[model samples]
Target: MALAHRILTIRRDPHSGEVLARGGDPEAHSLLERSGFVPVVRRHETYHRLPTGLDQDEEIRLATRAVARLQTVGYDLDTDPVFATERREPHYLSLGDQVRHLAVRIREAESTEEVADALTELTATHDGILAALTKVLHTAADFLQDLGHPADPHTAARLRHLADERLHVLASDLRHVRNDLADRQAVHPHRAPCPQEVAGDEREKSASCPCPAPARIPTTPSAPAAAPPAPAGRRR
Candidate 1:
C-alpha cells in the first residue's frame, strides 16, 4: 500500500521574482511562513508535494482538505496523483454520515465558540464537496467539446447533470445550516459576555449576550430545490 501524504506548493512570479501562490492545510501554511515565503504578486502557478495522516473523522477531513486544495489549482480526483495511489476506503465518509455528524455537533455545542467551530467545519465540508463536483462538470464538458467528441455525449451530459444536482443539494444544505446557526446564536444567549466587556462594565451585567454575527447568505433568483434521486442502486 502507498503511504498517505498531504502536499502543497508555492509558485514564484516570473517577473520581479516573488512568492506568487501558496496553499494547503495549516501545517503547509506554517511551513511556508517558516521558510520566509511572504505573499506577493503572482505571474505563474505550480503544484508541489508533501507527505502526511489521521484517524476516522479526522482522516475524512484531511482527505476533504486535500481535494479542496487541489481543486483550487485546477486539479481534481481524476488527475491528482496522490489520490491515485492513496488508500481511500479508510478515509471515505458518506455524505449522509457527514451531515449527521455535523448536526450532532451543532446540537451539542455548549458555547458560542463551539458553535462557531462546528459551523466553520460544516462550511468547509460543503465547500470541499462543491469544488470536487464543480470540477467534475468542467472536466466532462471539456471532454465533450473536444474533436470527434471521443466520449459518448449522452453519458457526459448525464454526469454533468448529476454533478450539478449534487452541487445544488450541497449549497441548499449549507444555506439552511447557516440560517439555523444564525437563528440559534441570536436567541439562545446562555453564555457570558466577552471578558474585555465585563472588565469595563461597572454593574457586571448578567444580560443575555449575543453570539457573533452569522455568515451572510445571498438570495437565489429561483426557489430552492432538492437533489432528485438517481436511478435505483446508483448512489449520488
Candidate 2:
C-alpha cells in the first residue's frame, strides 16, 4: 500500500504542477494532498500478486465509450488543421490508451482480490491520464500566453473546467472501487469474525468503560495568591 500511495503521490504532483502552471484554481492543491497517502504495503503487494486475465472485449468496449464521450466534448484534434499541425492529439491518445489498458485489467479480473488489484492499477493510470491532460492544457495556455496577447479567457476556462470535471469523476470512481472491495470482503468466506465479536462482553468489560467516572488529571499546585500591593506612598 505504501508503494501504491507513493505512485499516486508521484502521479498527482505532476498534475498539480500543471494546474498551477495554467493559473487554474489553487484548491486543486488541497484536493491532491488529500488524495495521496501511504498505503499498507503488505496488503497492496498481496493484491498486486493476485492472478487475473485481461478482458480484451471489455477493454475495447470501455475505450469506445470513452472515445464517444470525448467526441461529444469536441475532442477532434485531428480534424482541426491547426491542432493537428500542433500534434497534441498523440499525447491525449496515449493517455486514453493507458486508461483503456487499466479498464481491460479491471474487466478481466476473476476474484475480488484481483479486482482490487486492478482497481489500484486503474487509479494509478487515471492519475497519469489526468497529469498528462493537465500538461497539455498548460501547454496550450502557455502557447496562447506567448502570442503577445493575454491568454484566451475562453480557452483557459474550458481547460480548467475539463480538469475539474475529470477530477470529480476520478474521485467518484475511486470511491466506487473502495466500496466494491469492502462489499466483496464482507461476503468472503475466509474472513474471520472480528476479535471483538469473539471476545464479546467480557472483552468490553476488560477494557475500561467510557461511561465510568473520569480519572482526575494531575496538576501542579497553584502558585500562592499574590500578596496585596502596599498602599501607595505608605511605608511597606
Candidate 3:
C-alpha cells in the first residue's frame, strides 16, 4: 500500500544538532514545507535536524507531543517501527511488547493504506513467533515423553504449558489483525486500473496500441498447518 501521508522520525543529537535518524516520504516533506515545524536543512535531507540542547529523553518527549498534536488534527505521522527508540534489539522484546506495538499501530493508522501496512507487518511477525513457540512446545513434549521415568517432570510440563498459552495469545492477535485488515480493505478497496486510460492520453496512442486487462486472482482459505503432534502419552 502506498503511504498517503509521509510521517518520519526525526532523531538528532541533543547538543551537536547532528541528525541521528531522518527519513520521510515526499508527502511528508511537502507537508513539512507548509507547516510551522521548521526543520534545519544542512548539506541535504539526511543532515536536516532540529537543534536542541535538551536531554535526549526530553527531546523525545517533545517530539512525541508534537506528533500527537499533528495526529489530533488528522495528520498521519509515521512513528511506529521507530517510535522514540530506534530498535528494541529483538532479543529483549517480550511477547507482550510485540502485541502492544501492533495494537498501537493499528489504532493509530488513519488510512486504509496505513492499516494494510500495519496488518502485513503484524501477520509476518506473529507467524514467525507462533511457529517458534509451537516448536518449543513440541520439543518439550517430546522430552517429557522420552524421560518417562526421569526426575524433574514438572519442568518440562511447565515449559509446554507456557508455550501453549503464548501460542494461543499470538493466534488471537493474528485473528484480530486479520479482521482489522479485512474491515479496512472493505471500506477502502483498491481501485482497479483502467488499462486503456493508463496506456496513454493521446488519441493516436490509444487507437494504435492495445493493453490486456489485468487478471483477477481468486482467494481461497487453505487448511491450517498442523502443529507437531504431542507425544503419544500427552494430550494434544
RMSD of each: 28.1, 22.7, 29.9
Off by over 4 Å in 3: 1-104, 119-127, 140-151, 186-236
Model 2: per-residue Cα lDDT over 55-126, one tens digit each: 534433333332333333234311211112221212134344666687676565555676676566544454
* lDDT, ranked from best to worst: 3, 1, 2
Superposition error at 20 for model 1 (Å): 47
TM-score of 3: 0.27
Question: Cα miss at 25, model 3 (Å)?
Answer: 35
Total residue pair clashes for candidate 2: 4
Model 1 RMSD vs true structure: 28.1
Residue pairs clashing in model 1 are 5-52, 6-52
Expressed as tens digits, the lDDT of each residue in 1-236 for candidate 1 is: 11122444333335833323244444434333333334333468333322222333443344345444444433324322323333322234546567668678767666645665566654555465456557768697668755465566766777777767867687668757765665665533454444433334556477443455557899768976888987788668
Query: Pairs clashing in candidate 3?
Result: 7-78
lDDT value, residue 131 of candidate 3: 63
lDDT of 3 by residue, 1-236 (tens): 25543345554556965433345554344333333235556775442343346565654654554454445444454453323333212123446567669778767655665666666654555465466667778797778866866654777777777767867687678757766766755433233333454344665743642446568898898999999987778558
C-alpha local distance difference test of each model:
0.50, 0.42, 0.54
Candidate 2 vs 3: which has more lDDT: 3
Name the TM-score of candidate 2: 0.31
